[model samples]
Target: MASKHDIPLTGSSVNIVKKCGPALNDILNSKFGCGATFSGVDFERDLSIAHQKSSYVGPDRRFGVTLHSGVEVSVWKADLTNLSVDAVVNAANTDLQHVGGLAWALSKAGGPQIQRDSDDHIRKNGPLLTGEAIISAPGKLPCKNIIHAVGPQLTDPSYISSAEPFLEKAINSILDRVKTNKLNTVAIPAISSGLFNYPLPQCANTIVKTVKRYYEGVFFNIGHIPKEILLVNHDDLTVQEMERACREILAPHLAVPNSQTTARKTRSAAKTSTPTVQIANVCLTLMKGRIEDQPTDVIVNTASPDLKLSTGEISKALLQKAGPEIQNAIKNTPPKGYVIRTPSYKLPCKEVYHTRCTDRGAHGAEKVLWKSVSDCLWLTAASFYKSIAFPAIGTGNLKFTRKESARILLDAVNQFAQNSTQKMNVYFVIFPSDHGTFQAFEEQMKWLQAPRGPTPEASEKRDPFPNTRTPPPQISLTGPSIESLFEADKWLGHLFKSSGTIEIYNNFIQHFSHNDYVQLSRLQQNGVSVEEFFTAGHACITLNGPSDEVAVAALQVEAMLCSVQKDFVAEEEGEMLLLSSAGNNVPFERKRVDRSTQEFKDKAAAFHKQGLRISKLDKVENSTLQLLFNLKKNQLQCHATEEMFQRVPAQFCEMVSHVGFHAEFAPPEDPAYGEGIYFASTAKKAMEVWKGKREEYLYFVEAEVLTGSSVPGRRGLFLPPALGTEPLRVHDSVSGGSDISVIFSGYQALPKYIITCQK
Candidate 1:
C-alpha cells in the first residue's frame, strides 16, 4: 500500500480539507478511488470527514429513473467502498477469494470478516455458478451487509451466448438478496466489467436493464425490494456507460401520438419469399426466421410447466436474447393459465407471450397446445395489437411431430382468423436453423387457403345450381298456388346464405360456472348459433350465424373469456394479500437512536431549522438522520387527516409490499393529484404532506421515492400525462397541489422507517 504522505492534494482531497477544518493531515494521508479500501462513510459524508473522508463516489450523476413504488435507480461515478448503504454488492468469483479487482477492494475495507464469512459460505454451499449469488456480513465496512454474486468471464467458451443469462442471474441474485434481507439501499458495481473480461458497455447495460426490469416487476407484482439501487463505480468510463444505459433503458415515456404501428420487415428478409394467404380480415404469413428478432407487436415463447423461460431450447434462446430482465418479469407475475405476458426486454418485439404446454402425454397434449396458441391470439387481439409472431410450438422437447404440431397449432390460428372481426397480420415464424419445421408450417399455410369451408364455386358445382336447373320440389301448403311457389323459393335461399362459423377452444372451465350458459342462451334467443362441447379435459364454445351477428356474439364471448381469466389473476392476488400482512411480509428496519451522539444534535438542528419542533425522532444510527434509503427517498413525511393533503397518491402507499396497486393511484380520498404515490422534496413539505387533523398522535414514514421529471398536475389523472402538445413524452411525476410530488407507480417508493412522535 502507498504511504499516506505519497497521496496528492487533488480536487476532492483539497475540498475535503476546506469543508472539514483542521483535518489537513488526515485528508493528505488517505488514498482516494482505490478499490481495495473504502472509508464506508454515510451519504451525509458528502459534507463530512476526508481526514479527507470521501464517500465512494466522485461527482458524476444520479442519472436514473424512479419506479412506480418510489424506488430510485441511480448511476454514479464513485468508489463502491465509500457508499454507506444497507448493503454493498461485491462482484466475486466462484471460490470467494478476494484477491483482486472489486473483490479485493471490498474485502480490504470490510476487513477479514468478509473473507472469513465468504470462505465459510463457499465451504458449506460449494462454488457458485456464474449467475448465482450469496450474502456475507459486513466486517469493518460502514454498510451492514454484503452480497457476493458471480458473473461470467470471457475465458468461458461462447461467453456471448452464456454471458447475458449468467450476468442476469448475478444481477437478479443481488436484487433477491436485497429483497430477502430487506435492505433499504444497495450499491452495486458493474459486475464482470473488471477482470472478468465482459465488455464494459454491455455489462453496464445488462446491469441497468436488469435493475429497471426488476423494478418493473415490483410495480406489477407489488413485491418488496430495496428503496434505492445505486450503480456505483470509481472510473469515469464505467459510470458513463452505466448512465447511458440507464437513460436509454429506463427513460420515461412521453405521451405518444396516435400513429400507425405497422410491422416493419427486417433488412435481410425477402418480402416476396414469405408465404402468405388471407383468411377473413387477417393475413396469415409463414416466415422462416428467429422468433425473437421479428419486429411484431407480440412474439411467442414456449415455457415449461413451471412457466420458466429458460427450461426449453426455444425459450432459453428467447430468454438469452431478452436478457434476465424477462426472467425477473416472469417470476414476479406468474402465468395465469397457459401463458404469461411480459414486456420484451432486448427482443425486437414489444411483448413476449410466454406459453406453457407441458402435457407430455398424448391424451391432453393437443388440448394444451390449442390453449397455448389460442391464448396468444386472444391476448394479442385484446391488447389491440395488429400483428403477432408465433414460434413452432408443438415440436421441440414436447416431442410432437413437425407436421402434426404445425397443423394443430395452425388450426387454432385458422379458427381465430375466421372469427375475429378485426384486421390482423398473424405470422408463424420457424427458426432459421429448423428447415423441417418451416416446411411443415408452409404446407399447412397452403392448406389453410385450400378450404376451411365450401367455396362459392365448389358449392355451386356440388349442388349443380348455377349450371343446371334444380328440380322444383312438390310444395304441399294449405294455400293458393302463389304460396306454394313462395315456399319453394325460400328453400333455395336457406342453402345460398352460408353460415359464418367460429370455433373457440379450451375454455377456462370456470366460465361455465359464471353466466356462460346464460350468455350462450341469450345468443341463441338473438338468432346467433351457439354450441358448447368438451374435448380432452377442456370445454369449447362455438358461435355461428351471419357475419355481423357472429361478430356481435364474438364480442360477448370475448367478455366471458376475459372474466374467466380474471378468476385466475384475482385468485393469485388474494393469496398475495394473505402473504403480505405478517412477520417478514413487509421489510422495514428500525434501530433505537443514540441520543447522546453529537451527530444526533446536528440532525436535530437540521430538523428544528425547518420550522418544526421534533417531539421525538424515534430511530437513529449514532448522530445521522436520513429519510431516503434508496427509494429516491426523501427525509420523512408527517401524516395529515381531514386536510386537503390528507389524501396522498391517495391509496398507492396502502398497497405497498405486494401491497400491490391502488384502484385509482391517487391519494386516499383525493384523486385530483396525478395518479401516483406522493413525495415531498423538503422536510417542511414532508411534514405538511403527512400532518394529520390532530397533532398529539403523529406518524411519519421515512421513504426512498424516485420522483424524476415532473410537471404541474390536476386531479382525476391516472398516469403522468403527456407534457406537450407535440411530443410523445409523458412526465414521470406531477407537482402536487399540496406542494408535493406524485408518481404513478408503486415501485418508485420504498418505505424505510416508520417513526411515531408525540407533539
Candidate 2:
C-alpha cells in the first residue's frame, strides 16, 4: 500500500521511481519515513498520472531501443534542472560563471549552492580546460549530481581547428564521471552551442557519436554502462536538432533487426570480390587516386547541407586548389540537396559539382545520396559533358560504411544510365589512404561485371583497355572573364572602365533642338560621347562611355530639358520673373549681353511695377533671356532651375530625342525615386534607379514636340503620332515580349521623360 503523499510529487518524481525503483523506495522509506509500496498497479497508475501532468518518461521506457552495450538513449525537450536522472551535464565556461543559456538557467533553478560548489572546485583546480569536467552535489535540482563540463569555445577561431577533439573529450569526461559513480541514468544538453558557437548540426552529430562510442566500450572498460542516456534541451531548435542526430546515428543501429548478423554478412561480402556487369550505355570504372588529379569533365565534392566544404582529405584538397571564389559562389546559391556548379580553378577538371549528402541521418542517407548522384549524371548528360568522377560521398566524416556507400552510389549511376538517353563515362576515384573503401568498391565492381545474364548494351561498347590510356588534356578556354572578375571583386572601382552601347529612336519628333545639342555637348565634355541624328520626324541618339559616365551624362541632359520646359511655362504665363535664384546654375559658361532697347526697358519696368523683381538675367542665344527672379511679396519660387525662357514661343520646338546608353556595371536601386531629376543633385541616386530599371526594361529618352503649329492650350497634353507614321522599335533582351512599347504619358510636362519598352 502507498499513501497519497508518497504517490510521486510530479512526472519527474515518477521518473525517479522508474529509474531506481527498488533503490528509490528503500531510500525514501529509510530517510524520510514515507513508506511506499511498489507493485505493477502502483507503478503504472503513478506513471500514467505523471505522464498526463508533465509527459516525462525514462529513456528505456520511452524509446524501445537497446544499444550494443545494452544502453538506451532518448531525447527530450525539457529543463535540465527538472530531470530526475542521476546527473545533468552543464555546458560551463572555463571560469564557470552562470552567465547565459543552459548554465544560467540551471544555476537559477538549482539554487546558489550549485554555484558555490562550482566556485570551490574552480578555486582548487584553477580553471577548467576544454574536455575537463567536475562533479558537484545538486543543491535543489531533482538530479542527484551536476556535471559541470568545460567545452571548447567554437566561436573562437583558434579553437575551431580543434573543436571536434575537444568536444569528444568533454563528452568522455562526463562519461568518466558517470562510470566512476556507477550512475544508471543521466541527462545532457547540447554542449558549446550557446556561447561557444559550435554549429548545431555538428554539435548534435558529434555528441551522439561520442556517446554511442562510449557505450560500445571504445573509451571505457567493458561491462561499465549507464542504463539510460537522455539528450535533453529546453530550446525547441536544439531539441529538434538533437532528435534528428539521434535518429540518424542511434536509431539505425537499434532499429535494424539482427544487426550482428547483418554486420557479419557485410564483413564476409567485403572479403570477396564481385564481378562488374553493364546495365545501360554507361560504363562504371573504379580507380585509386586523388579525385582532384582525375582528368574528367567534372568532379563531385561532398559537402554539408550548408555547402560547407570539409576541412580534411579530398574536400580540403579541392578547396585549397579551387581558391575562395568557389566558396563564395556556393554561399550565394541555395544549399541543401541541390547540385551547384563552379569553376575548378587549378584542378584538372573543367568544372566541379558541389553536392550535399551528409547529415541526412540513417533513413534518408540512401535517398539523399541517390538524388545527389542522379542530379550529377543528369546535369552532365544535359550539358554534353562526356565524363564525371565521384568520391565516396558519405563514407568519410558522415561515418557511412564504405560497402554501403559503394552499393548506393553504383545503384544510382546504373539506374540513371538505363533510363537516360545520353551516354557518359563515370569513374569512382578513391585516394590511396582509403584502401578499405577502394577494396570495397573493387569488390562491388567485380561482382557487377560477373557474367550472370545476357551481355548488356554498355558491355558491348566498353573499351577493352579502358585503364591503359590517360584522357587527353582538355583545352580550357574558360579563363576568368573580366565580367566575372568584376562580379567577384566589386570593390575594384577601376574595373568600371569597361563600356557598352545601346541605340534609341523615336518616330514622333525628328531632329535635336538647340537645347538638345547643347546638352549633348555638355555630356561629351564630361567623358560621354553622344551621337545625334534626325530625319523626317524621327530622331536618334547613340550614347557610349563608361557606365558611370554615361549615367551622369544622361541625367544632366534630362535636367537641362526639364529646366527649359519650366522656363517655357513661366514665359507663357508672363511670370518669367518668378524664376528662383537657387535653381540649377547652367553647367556651361553664360555670356551676358547689354539690353538697351527702349521697348525692353519699358517692359522690364512694367514687370517691376507689378511686384516682380528679376534678380539676375543672362542671354541664352540671340533673342532669348535666361532670367532668375522672385516675387516681391514673398519668396515663392522653384529652386532646381535658374534659366527662364526662349524668346520665340512658337519656335520653341518640343524636340523629342530618343537616346540609348549602356553601362558595364550594375547599380543597386535608389531609395529615393525622383531625387536627382530636378537638380542633378543625386547623381548616384539617379544611376541606381537607371540600373535597377535596366534589369527589366530597355530605356529611352523622349522629348515632347513643341512645334510652331502646336496649339497653346494643348501644350502638355498626351498627343499621338501621325496616323501614317511608323512606330519606333527598340530591341531589348531582358524583357520577354518582342513588340512591347512603353509610352511616356506626360513627356512634355515632366522635367525628364524616360521611356521604357518591355522587350
Candidate 3:
C-alpha cells in the first residue's frame, strides 16, 4: 500500500497512469528511470528519506501545507526566482512543439536539447495520459531535471471542466517528484490558459489553492518533508490576473518581511553625499518639474505612512507617496537646465530616467495620464539623444491600470519617434504581478509588425470573407425563419472549425457536457445537410394537425410528449438563424438561455441525467423545433474506442454526400480515426442558423415555382400558432382545390449570451 505521505491534503492522491497496471519489469524500469544510480543498499528507505527532505515547508494554514510559501498563503509580494529549483514543471499537451506561450519561452531558454529529449521521450512513451508525469534532463536550464506533466486532455469534459482535475494532478505530481529527488526548490508557471482554454482567474485560484492545500497537512504524511516552493512569475495577462486573485484569496496570511536590515544596507551601499528626498504622491511630483527639464530618475518611495495596516492597501498607497521624491530629485539638480529638444523622451547622452505617476480613477483618464508622462520622458530623451532605459512613469502608486498604461506609454513612445532625431528605448521596470501591463505592451509591438493601409491594388482583399480555400458556409435565404438559432459562444469556435465531426463532437463533450449550458450546432460542416446531422440522434417531432383541429391536436401531441418528458424546454423557433447572425447583428435575447429561470435550471439538470437533451418553446413567433436523443456511446467524449459509428440511412447519406462538406478527421494513429476534414459551400448560412438562436426577428424562406405559385417560408419553425403553420407553407397560386399547410415545430435553444461569437 502507498504510504500516508503520498496522499495530498486535497483528499486522495491522483491516478498517475490511466490505462495500465504496473508489472515487475515496469517497476524496475521506473526505478531505473528515476536514476537511482547511487551504489548502496536500503534503496527504498533511502529514496523515501530523500523524498521527505525535499518536500516544501509551505505556510501554516487551516486548508493545509502548500507547495510554495506564498502560492498557498500569498505571504510574499515579489516574483519568485525561476532558476532555483530541482525541476520546473511545464504545463504541456500531447504535442510538445513549443508555440507562442510560456511553454515556448521555456523551450527557448532550455535550448534545442530539451526539445530533442522531450520528443525522444514522447516517442518512446507515446502521448502522456492526463495527470501523468515523465522526467528528462533539464538540458541548458539551471535546474537538474524538468518534469513534463501532461495535465488534462482537451478532448472531453471541455478544457474548463477538466482544468481543476488536471491542476490537482499536476500539483501532486510535482510534489511527489520533488520529494523523491530531494530537491528543495521548484518553480512553476501558470498552467492551462493558452490554447488549453481554461479561464485565467479560475486557473490561478486552483493552482494556488491546490498547492497550498498539499503543503499543509500532506507534508507530515511524506515523512515530514520540509521544503520551499516558488511560483515563478509570468509576463502575461493570465499571471497578472492570477496574482490579483491570489492576493485576495491569501489576504489573511499575507505578511511583509521587516526588510529594515536589507533596505538599510541597500541605502548605505548606494550612499550618495547628496540629500535624500522623498515624495508621498506621484501626480504632484510629475507635475512639479518643468516639462522642458524633467528629472532623469523618478524614485517611488514605498515606505508605509507610519501606521499598522494590510499589505494591499500599503502597496496601493506606495506609488502615491513616491510622487514627492520626483519633485525633490528635480530640485536637487544643478542650476544648469538639460537641453529639451524633441517631443519623444530621449535626450542627447543621459541614458535612463524614471518618473512617478498614479491610477486615479477610470481606465480612460489613466490612458491620458500615462501618455503625458511618456511625452515628458521622450522630451528628456530628446534633450540627451540616447538615454538608458527607464522605469515606466506612472505604474507605481498612481495605480494606473496596467493594460492602459502600457498602451498609452507605447503609443507615446511611437509618436515621439515620428520626427525626433534622438531615439530612446524604454523599459517599464515593472513590479511583480504586472504581466497584464507587459502583455498590452507586447501586443502593441506585435501589431506594429504588420503592414498598414488600403489600396486599389487590394481589390482581392476588399471582401471580408476571402475565399482562401473553401469559404466559410453562407445562408442565402431571407425572411423570419432565418433569424433564430444559437451558436455555442466564443470559446467553442475552434471546435466548430476543427477538421472532423468526431473531433468537434469530442471537443463539445469535453467543454460543455459537464457545465450547465447546452452545446448546439447547425450543419456538421460548411455544406453538410441537416438531415445527416440530425440522424446521429433519435429525433422525435410533434405535429399540429390541420388548422381546424390545430389547438386540440397540438395540445394532445404536446401532452403526449410531455408525459414522456424526462427533461425538456419549449421554444418557438429553430436556432439556425441565431447561429448565422453571430457574425452580424445576431439578436442577443433569443441567443442566450436565461439561467436564472427555474425552468431552465431544471431542464439543465435533466439534460445531465437522461443521457439525452431538451429544447423548449415558451412562445413561438413564427417557427419552432425540438429533439430528443439517447447518447448510447459517448465516443466523442471518451478516449479512442473500438466502437464504430452507426451507418446512417441511404437517402440521408446520399443527401449528405451531395451537399457534402469538405472536412477531415485523421487521428494521430496508424489507422487514424477522424482528424482533418473541411466542408465547403454557400449553404453555410443555413448551417449557422441551424446551430444558433434568433430572438428579435423571424427568419423566413419563401419559394416560388415555375408557374409563379408562391409558397410561405418554411424556415420559421418557431412561429406562434397564431401565425398559423398552414400560412407558413401556403401557395400563392390560387389553384382549383389544393389545400396547403406548412410543417413547423418548436426548437431546443442553446445558451447564446455566454457563448456569442464576436463578429
Where does the lowest 10-residue lDDT sum fall in candidate 2?
Answer: 658-667
Question: What root-mean-square deviation over C-alphas does model 2 reach?
Answer: 30.6
lDDT against the true structure, each candidate: 0.59, 0.53, 0.34
Q: Which tens-of-lDDT digit does each residue in 1-759 have in candidate 1?
A: 111111222323233223222221121111111111111111111111101122234445558678766889988777777667898888888878775567767777887888888878878989888798888788988888889889987755456666788898889889888888788998898888766768877888888878877778656674675678889886545665787787777774622222221124333443335776666546788887778789999989887877677788888889889999888898787675788889898998899888878655757777788778888986676455778998888788888889768767877776666444345788988777676687667655655555444422342222212343432211111111222223223321222232566665433543454225544665675577888886423356778876545644544554455444444445534544353333322333345445677745654575567654444333423111122222223211212211111122211222222233232222333335644566665556655554445433334444555556668888667678786884566776777654577767544455443333334
Best by lDDT: 1
Distance from true position, residue 359, model 1, in Å?
A: 4.2
The RMSD (Cα, Å) of candidate 1 is: 33.1
lDDT of 3 by residue, 1-759 (tens): 100011111101011111111111122112111100100111111111000111112321112223333323322222222364577777766656543244545666677787788778778878777776667787777677787766653433355664688777877787778777776666666666544545656777777777666766465566435355655543323434555555555553643332453344443332221111111001011111122133333222221222111233322333234333433443343321221121122322222232323345745445445445544544443233323333344454556555445545554454444323222333333433444444444444433322242322343232222332431222111111111111111111222222322111211111221111110111112232211111221132222222222222222222222222211111111233342232222122222346668856664464335232323212111111111100111211222212111111111221111111111111111111112211111112222222323322211111111112323332212322232356664332111112222211111111111111111
How many pairs collide in each candidate, listed in order? 63, 16, 125
Evaluation by lDDT, superior candidate among 1 and 2: 1
Per-prediction RMSD in angstroms?
Answer: 33.1, 30.6, 26.8
